[model samples]
Target: MSSSRILLASRCATEDEISELVFKLQALLPERRRQHLRRVSRDEVLEEVCSYIRKLHKQVDDTSERISQLLASADLDADVLRSLLQQ
Candidate 1:
Protein backbone atom coordinates (compact mmCIF):
# COMPACT_ATOMS: atom_id res chain seq x y z
CA MET A 1 0.00 0.00 0.00
CA SER A 2 1.07 3.59 -0.62
CA SER A 3 2.26 5.70 2.33
CA SER A 4 -0.80 7.99 2.19
CA ARG A 5 -3.24 5.12 2.16
CA ILE A 6 -1.47 3.45 5.09
CA LEU A 7 -1.66 6.68 7.11
CA LEU A 8 -5.36 7.09 6.32
CA ALA A 9 -6.12 3.56 7.41
CA SER A 10 -4.26 4.04 10.69
CA ARG A 11 -6.15 7.26 11.38
CA CYS A 12 -9.49 5.60 10.73
CA ALA A 13 -8.69 2.76 13.12
CA THR A 14 -7.73 5.24 15.86
CA GLU A 15 -10.96 7.18 15.42
CA ASP A 16 -13.00 4.01 15.62
CA GLU A 17 -11.28 2.99 18.85
CA ILE A 18 -11.93 6.40 20.40
CA SER A 19 -15.57 6.28 19.39
CA GLU A 20 -15.99 2.85 20.94
CA LEU A 21 -14.46 4.01 24.22
CA VAL A 22 -16.78 7.02 24.38
CA PHE A 23 -19.80 4.81 23.82
CA LYS A 24 -18.70 2.52 26.63
CA LEU A 25 -18.27 5.45 28.98
CA GLN A 26 -21.73 6.71 28.16
CA ALA A 27 -23.17 3.29 28.85
CA LEU A 28 -21.61 3.28 32.31
CA LEU A 29 -23.55 6.41 33.31
CA PRO A 30 -26.94 6.15 35.00
CA GLU A 31 -30.05 5.74 32.84
CA ARG A 32 -31.60 9.00 34.03
CA ARG A 33 -28.50 10.97 33.08
CA ARG A 34 -28.32 9.35 29.67
CA GLN A 35 -32.01 9.68 28.89
CA HIS A 36 -31.98 13.42 28.27
CA LEU A 37 -29.08 13.37 25.88
CA ARG A 38 -29.45 12.12 22.33
CA ARG A 39 -26.66 12.21 19.76
CA VAL A 40 -24.14 13.52 22.30
CA SER A 41 -20.62 14.57 21.39
CA ARG A 42 -17.39 13.39 23.02
CA ASP A 43 -17.11 16.56 25.12
CA GLU A 44 -20.63 16.07 26.54
CA VAL A 45 -19.82 12.50 27.56
CA LEU A 46 -16.70 13.68 29.40
CA GLU A 47 -18.63 16.42 31.20
CA GLU A 48 -21.25 13.97 32.42
CA VAL A 49 -18.59 11.59 33.68
CA CYS A 50 -16.90 14.38 35.58
CA SER A 51 -20.17 15.46 37.17
CA TYR A 52 -20.96 11.91 38.25
CA ILE A 53 -17.52 11.50 39.80
CA ARG A 54 -17.86 14.73 41.76
CA LYS A 55 -21.24 13.70 43.14
CA LEU A 56 -19.83 10.36 44.27
CA HIS A 57 -16.92 12.01 45.99
CA LYS A 58 -19.24 14.33 47.87
CA GLN A 59 -21.34 11.39 49.05
CA VAL A 60 -18.28 9.55 50.34
CA ASP A 61 -17.11 12.57 52.28
CA ASP A 62 -20.52 13.12 53.82
CA THR A 63 -20.83 9.50 54.89
CA SER A 64 -17.39 9.46 56.42
CA GLU A 65 -18.10 12.57 58.43
CA ARG A 66 -21.38 11.16 59.72
CA ILE A 67 -19.69 7.94 60.79
CA SER A 68 -17.02 9.84 62.67
CA GLN A 69 -19.61 11.86 64.52
CA LEU A 70 -21.51 8.75 65.54
CA LEU A 71 -18.38 7.07 66.78
CA ALA A 72 -17.39 10.12 68.82
CA SER A 73 -20.80 10.47 70.42
CA ALA A 74 -20.85 6.82 71.39
CA ASP A 75 -17.57 7.21 73.36
CA LEU A 76 -16.38 3.83 72.21
CA ASP A 77 -12.95 2.51 73.20
CA ALA A 78 -10.12 3.36 70.80
CA ASP A 79 -9.38 -0.27 70.05
CA VAL A 80 -13.04 -1.06 69.43
CA LEU A 81 -13.48 1.92 67.14
CA ARG A 82 -10.38 1.05 65.18
CA SER A 83 -11.56 -2.54 64.72
CA LEU A 84 -15.01 -1.40 63.68
CA LEU A 85 -13.57 0.99 61.14
CA GLN A 86 -11.37 -1.74 59.75
CA GLN A 87 -14.39 -3.95 59.25
Candidate 2:
Protein backbone atom coordinates (compact mmCIF):
# COMPACT_ATOMS: atom_id res chain seq x y z
CA MET A 1 0.00 0.00 0.00
CA SER A 2 1.07 3.61 -0.53
CA SER A 3 2.40 5.62 2.42
CA SER A 4 -0.72 7.79 2.29
CA ARG A 5 -2.98 4.79 2.77
CA ILE A 6 -0.68 3.50 5.51
CA LEU A 7 -0.87 6.82 7.33
CA LEU A 8 -4.64 6.73 7.08
CA ALA A 9 -4.51 3.24 8.54
CA SER A 10 -2.63 4.43 11.64
CA ARG A 11 -3.78 4.35 15.27
CA CYS A 12 -7.52 4.26 14.65
CA ALA A 13 -7.55 1.33 12.26
CA THR A 14 -9.23 -1.82 13.54
CA GLU A 15 -7.33 -5.12 13.48
CA ASP A 16 -9.79 -6.39 10.84
CA GLU A 17 -9.18 -3.32 8.71
CA ILE A 18 -5.44 -3.79 8.89
CA SER A 19 -5.76 -7.45 8.02
CA GLU A 20 -7.93 -6.61 5.02
CA LEU A 21 -5.42 -4.01 3.88
CA VAL A 22 -2.55 -6.42 4.27
CA PHE A 23 -4.50 -9.08 2.40
CA LYS A 24 -5.03 -6.76 -0.55
CA LEU A 25 -1.41 -5.70 -0.57
CA GLN A 26 -0.26 -9.30 -0.42
CA ALA A 27 -2.33 -10.20 -3.48
CA LEU A 28 -0.15 -7.89 -5.62
CA LEU A 29 3.00 -9.86 -4.76
CA PRO A 30 4.15 -13.05 -6.46
CA GLU A 31 3.09 -16.27 -4.70
CA ARG A 32 6.53 -17.15 -3.29
CA ARG A 33 7.13 -13.58 -2.11
CA ARG A 34 3.88 -13.45 -0.16
CA GLN A 35 5.48 -15.52 2.61
CA HIS A 36 7.93 -12.71 3.36
CA LEU A 37 5.10 -10.26 3.92
CA ARG A 38 3.34 -12.70 6.23
CA ARG A 39 6.38 -12.89 8.50
CA VAL A 40 5.48 -9.51 9.97
CA SER A 41 1.93 -8.27 10.30
CA ARG A 42 1.00 -4.58 10.16
CA ASP A 43 0.66 -4.47 13.96
CA GLU A 44 4.06 -6.12 14.36
CA VAL A 45 5.64 -3.49 12.11
CA LEU A 46 3.98 -0.69 14.08
CA GLU A 47 5.14 -2.14 17.40
CA GLU A 48 8.72 -2.53 16.12
CA VAL A 49 8.83 1.07 14.85
CA CYS A 50 7.44 2.30 18.18
CA SER A 51 10.05 0.27 20.07
CA TYR A 52 12.85 1.80 17.97
CA ILE A 53 11.50 5.29 18.50
CA ARG A 54 11.44 4.77 22.26
CA LYS A 55 15.06 3.54 22.15
CA LEU A 56 16.17 6.62 20.15
CA HIS A 57 14.30 8.96 22.52
CA LYS A 58 15.98 7.35 25.50
CA GLN A 59 19.39 7.81 23.88
CA VAL A 60 18.61 11.49 23.27
CA ASP A 61 17.52 11.96 26.90
CA ASP A 62 20.68 10.24 28.20
CA THR A 63 22.92 12.34 25.95
CA SER A 64 21.15 15.55 27.01
CA GLU A 65 21.59 14.67 30.69
CA ARG A 66 25.32 14.01 30.14
CA ILE A 67 25.69 17.37 28.36
CA SER A 68 23.90 19.12 31.23
CA GLN A 69 26.31 17.52 33.68
CA LEU A 70 29.27 18.63 31.57
CA LEU A 71 27.94 22.19 31.42
CA ALA A 72 27.26 22.27 35.15
CA SER A 73 30.87 21.28 36.00
CA ALA A 74 32.49 23.66 33.47
CA ASP A 75 33.65 27.20 34.23
CA LEU A 76 31.47 29.77 32.41
CA ASP A 77 34.52 31.58 30.89
CA ALA A 78 34.86 32.68 27.23
CA ASP A 79 37.27 29.79 26.42
CA VAL A 80 34.98 27.27 28.09
CA LEU A 81 32.00 28.62 26.11
CA ARG A 82 34.00 28.20 22.88
CA SER A 83 34.96 24.64 23.87
CA LEU A 84 31.30 23.83 24.51
CA LEU A 85 30.40 25.18 21.07
CA GLN A 86 33.02 22.90 19.49
CA GLN A 87 31.48 19.91 21.28
Candidate 3:
Protein backbone atom coordinates (compact mmCIF):
# COMPACT_ATOMS: atom_id res chain seq x y z
CA MET A 1 0.00 0.00 0.00
CA SER A 2 1.21 3.52 -0.82
CA SER A 3 1.73 5.69 2.24
CA SER A 4 -0.06 9.02 2.49
CA ARG A 5 2.26 11.98 2.81
CA ILE A 6 1.82 15.16 4.82
CA LEU A 7 3.31 18.43 3.61
CA LEU A 8 5.54 19.98 6.23
CA ALA A 9 8.90 21.69 6.61
CA SER A 10 11.94 19.85 7.94
CA ARG A 11 13.10 22.57 10.34
CA CYS A 12 16.08 20.59 11.62
CA ALA A 13 17.89 20.68 8.27
CA THR A 14 20.79 23.10 8.02
CA GLU A 15 21.66 25.48 5.19
CA ASP A 16 24.35 23.06 4.05
CA GLU A 17 21.80 20.24 3.87
CA ILE A 18 20.27 21.41 0.57
CA SER A 19 21.62 18.40 -1.31
CA GLU A 20 19.31 16.21 0.76
CA LEU A 21 16.48 18.72 0.33
CA VAL A 22 16.61 18.61 -3.46
CA PHE A 23 16.23 14.85 -3.35
CA LYS A 24 13.12 15.28 -1.17
CA LEU A 25 11.74 18.01 -3.40
CA GLN A 26 12.08 15.78 -6.43
CA ALA A 27 10.33 13.02 -4.54
CA LEU A 28 7.48 15.25 -3.37
CA LEU A 29 6.56 16.56 -6.82
CA PRO A 30 4.62 14.31 -9.16
CA GLU A 31 5.76 14.06 -12.79
CA ARG A 32 3.06 16.29 -14.27
CA ARG A 33 3.49 18.88 -11.52
CA ARG A 34 7.25 18.88 -12.09
CA GLN A 35 6.72 19.33 -15.80
CA HIS A 36 4.29 22.22 -15.17
CA LEU A 37 6.80 23.86 -12.82
CA ARG A 38 9.51 23.53 -15.43
CA ARG A 39 7.32 25.22 -18.05
CA VAL A 40 5.55 27.70 -15.74
CA SER A 41 4.96 31.34 -16.63
CA ARG A 42 7.44 33.96 -15.42
CA ASP A 43 5.16 35.25 -12.62
CA GLU A 44 4.49 31.75 -11.34
CA VAL A 45 8.18 30.91 -11.46
CA LEU A 46 9.11 34.00 -9.46
CA GLU A 47 6.41 33.34 -6.85
CA GLU A 48 7.46 29.72 -6.44
CA VAL A 49 11.11 30.69 -6.25
CA CYS A 50 10.33 33.24 -3.54
CA SER A 51 8.33 30.67 -1.59
CA TYR A 52 11.22 28.18 -1.75
CA ILE A 53 13.70 30.80 -0.57
CA ARG A 54 11.48 31.74 2.38
CA LYS A 55 11.13 28.10 3.38
CA LEU A 56 14.90 27.63 3.13
CA HIS A 57 15.42 30.65 5.38
CA LYS A 58 13.01 29.22 7.96
CA GLN A 59 14.79 25.83 7.85
CA VAL A 60 18.20 27.44 8.29
CA ASP A 61 17.03 29.52 11.26
CA ASP A 62 15.47 26.46 12.93
CA THR A 63 18.66 24.46 12.38
CA SER A 64 20.72 27.25 13.90
CA GLU A 65 18.63 27.32 17.08
CA ARG A 66 18.71 23.51 17.39
CA ILE A 67 22.50 23.51 17.05
CA SER A 68 22.76 26.15 19.76
CA GLN A 69 20.66 24.04 22.10
CA LEU A 70 22.81 20.97 21.40
CA LEU A 71 25.98 22.92 22.11
CA ALA A 72 24.58 24.22 25.40
CA SER A 73 23.41 20.74 26.36
CA ALA A 74 26.93 19.42 25.81
CA ASP A 75 28.37 22.36 27.82
CA LEU A 76 30.40 23.48 24.82
CA ASP A 77 31.42 27.07 24.14
CA ALA A 78 29.97 28.45 20.91
CA ASP A 79 28.05 31.54 19.89
CA VAL A 80 26.63 31.30 16.38
CA LEU A 81 24.98 34.69 16.69
CA ARG A 82 28.26 36.23 17.80
CA SER A 83 30.01 34.90 14.73
CA LEU A 84 27.24 36.07 12.42
CA LEU A 85 27.16 39.49 14.06
CA GLN A 86 30.96 39.77 13.95
CA GLN A 87 31.26 39.82 10.18
Between candidates 2 and 3, which one is better according to lDDT?
2
Candidate 2 error regions (>4 Å) = 1-38
* Winner on TM-score (1 vs 3): 1
Best by TM-score: 1
Per-candidate Cα lDDT values, in order, are: 0.86, 0.71, 0.59
- Candidate 2: lDDT of 8? 72
* Model 3 C-alpha lDDT versus the unseen true structure: 0.59
RMSD of 3: 15.9
Candidate 2, residues 16-59, lDDT tens digits: the string is 88778767656655565555557777765455545556777999
Which tens-of-lDDT digit does each residue in 10-85 have in candidate 3?
4455444654555446445556645667654545655555676788899999998987786667643448646754
Winning model by lDDT: 1
- Candidate 3 TM-score, true structure as reference: 0.46
What clash pairs does model 1 have? Answer: none
Q: Which ten residues in a row have the lowest lDDT in candidate 1?
A: 9-18
lDDT by residue (14-74, candidate 1, tens digit) is 6678789888888888999887555989899989988998999999999999998897689
User: Which stretches in model 1 have alpha-carbon errors above 4 Å?
Assistant: 1-13, 77-87
